[model samples]
Target: MLFLAEKRGQGQVLPPNTGDTCSNVTMLDSRPFSVLSTSVKSEIRKALAPDILAFAKATGISREDGFDLDKVRLDALQIPVNNKKNKLYIVHWGDMLFGVNGAIWIVEVNSHKGRNLIAPDEGRNRGRSFSGWGMQTLSSENGSYPELMFASKGYYAGGGAKADAQCVRKVGAFYKINTCPAGCDDNLNSR
Candidate 1:
């Protein structure tokens, strides 16, 4: 997707605000998802902040009293499922001062069942014991089903642990951990 950025005085510039929205924003003629807008990005952040915050709280990650909504980056990707139902993966990540915080939320549009599969990743890996997650989906070797994978390389100083897990899509709540090759860390595993 094409993204536009704004320039400021003295050659300072801001990161590309691909999530921005405004009344005058319009889509590019040839691109269905690309948008150009002058206003700040606020719509999705406002709508999803509560769920994000709650996820963090449930995982026991201590965050600052308030988060910078403008710093949040929201990404939506369509997941391929048969004709059964519609699935969209929503990922949100941002800097929360002391460290960065990131979370992935799965939204089942047709069923209206949306939930957080993992807690937000916060603080340094050394301090937190687990590095930030790398997420992707892999097809089962046996051709039974597809799996949403969350992998993390951890710090030995903290606990000498690592995590690799595959979660599958269900009807109501999706992404259940099928296998954790790294021997999951209870504190680090949110699902």
Candidate 2:
């Protein structure tokens, strides 16, 4: 195969080595994926805007289909990971901030690697107490965000601090961004 294809100048050509059959062979496809268009990128960023309800209502997107991707909002709110790791995500109904004042829908996550709101890091924030939401920069290069403020239910059972969990749900805002920077060409073949 190497000898026949090289003669046609289809790719890199190699000379036959003495008594070596696989000398000029390698196993890997050197193709790049289609990058997302700037417009799509912008849309993705816009979709993840802390004010998703406003955009959804404004865009006439009422609800999402269980498996239909068209119903999912695309955006760029992704956690930084290895270059080969997948960045795409599916927004769950529970994972969304839905309400009029969407600001109180989230709690704050302050970690060096930042926090994935959907999947809170328990190792770092276990039993660590936070005073309150005085105020701070709600956003950064990571895009706009919502604070996942915490509060104790103030109840106990069997002397153990039995606490109930609930979001502020006041002015809470955030959009679920489901997308790929490398545009959707799932087959991954260049046209």
Candidate 3:
């Protein structure tokens, strides 16, 4: 497990980051409310609002279609990669309505690189129908980048209900999906 140092010299314990690859998969638990100040959280949310709206639009949902920015749930974690000076943000946001849509954004502020894990078009099937999805992070051995698991549940083509999981890791400048159980291919083209 890695620990983050607080301003007062106290250590804040984070989830364990071990192994060459992500394993010991489990359902994602509720994240801590937030370690950031209220103003900082508001700023982050404001910065991401446009992207969220764009996603909804791409999924054929409009502002009048029950898409409310205020109703979205956002969770963020600030992680120090190489040192305390350099940091990365793991942000996850989901709609409060049935968890119909959600995404994970990994941002490296120092590097000016941001990766959106799920594409808007891929989020919904036909402009309205969508799967309920969630994400979990597993710290990598290097402790610089964490492996991610995206799990989703939805109906099958034949009307049968199904659930799926996929594992993703940062390779060079992009995130790639590793072969796993059924339904992992849903977000194959996502960045």
Candidate 4:
């Protein structure tokens, strides 16, 4: 995939927006994912805002219903593919006041195409102690894209808690869920 970087005024170059309709921003950094700067994350959020808004709308959530962009949480991972790399970003938001559980939008950005994976109903009963989503690289062999592990934890009613997880791998142009790990009883002693 070829990404052509566009130069703004002065010397500022925006991220490559490529073939995605969501936004025209792309990352120019060649460093590892651990060193992603704040500015890069901001650009990614801006690029993904439209898609996130659309998902929120489809889920019956609106800006008027406490769905502010400032409240959303963003997480990103860089996946190496051959000599190039693709970026995967997760945008999460919720309105517990309105009985809406947490929602997630995962967007994969590359020079060839852009794809999204959404968990419209996720993180329910995620208590105050519950952290946000987590991602791990399951496999990235022989220059091929990797399988990914996504996990989160939440509480059930009656003071019990559970952990949920899924494994996904890129198939063709999109990602497919491979397996759902058994949820753990975090509060078995409460029984």
Highest-scoring model, lDDT: 3
**Candidate 2 vs candidate 3, TM-score winner:** 3
List, residue by residue over 94-173, the lDDT tens digit for candidate 4. Answer: 33432322444455555555455432233222211112344344455414555554445456677765544455665665
Tens digits of per-residue lDDT for model 1 on 6-105? 3331111112222211111111122111121211123334445676565456556544845444444444433444435543433434224313223444
What are the runs in model 1 whose C-alpha is more than 4 Å off?
1-47, 55-71, 94-101, 111-131, 140-145, 157-172, 181-191
Per-candidate TM-score against the hidden true structure = 0.43, 0.17, 0.54, 0.48
Model 1 lDDT at residue 70:
46
| C-alpha-based local distance difference test score of model 3 | 0.49
User: Each candidate: how many clashes?
Assistant: 0, 18, 0, 3
How do the residues 1-191 of candidate 3 rate in per-residue lDDT, one tens digit apiece? 23344532211224544422223332222343255555445555665576777667767777787778766666555544554543455565554533644565554443233334334333343221223254445556435666666566666787876555656666665455655534334432131
Model 3 vs. true fold: TM: 0.54
Taken over the whole model, the C-alpha lDDT of each candidate is 0.36, 0.25, 0.49, 0.43
Q: Over 4 Å off in model 3, which ranges?
A: 1-13, 17-29, 32-35, 38-43, 59-71, 78-80, 97-101, 110-133, 139-143, 154-162, 180-191
Error of 4 at 142 (Å): 8.4
Cα deviation of 46, candidate 2, in Å: 21
Judge candidate 2 at residue 84 and give its lDDT.
38
Kindly give the stretch of ten consecutive residues in candidate 3 with the minimal lDDT sum. Answer: 20-29
Model 3 RMSD in angstroms = 7.2
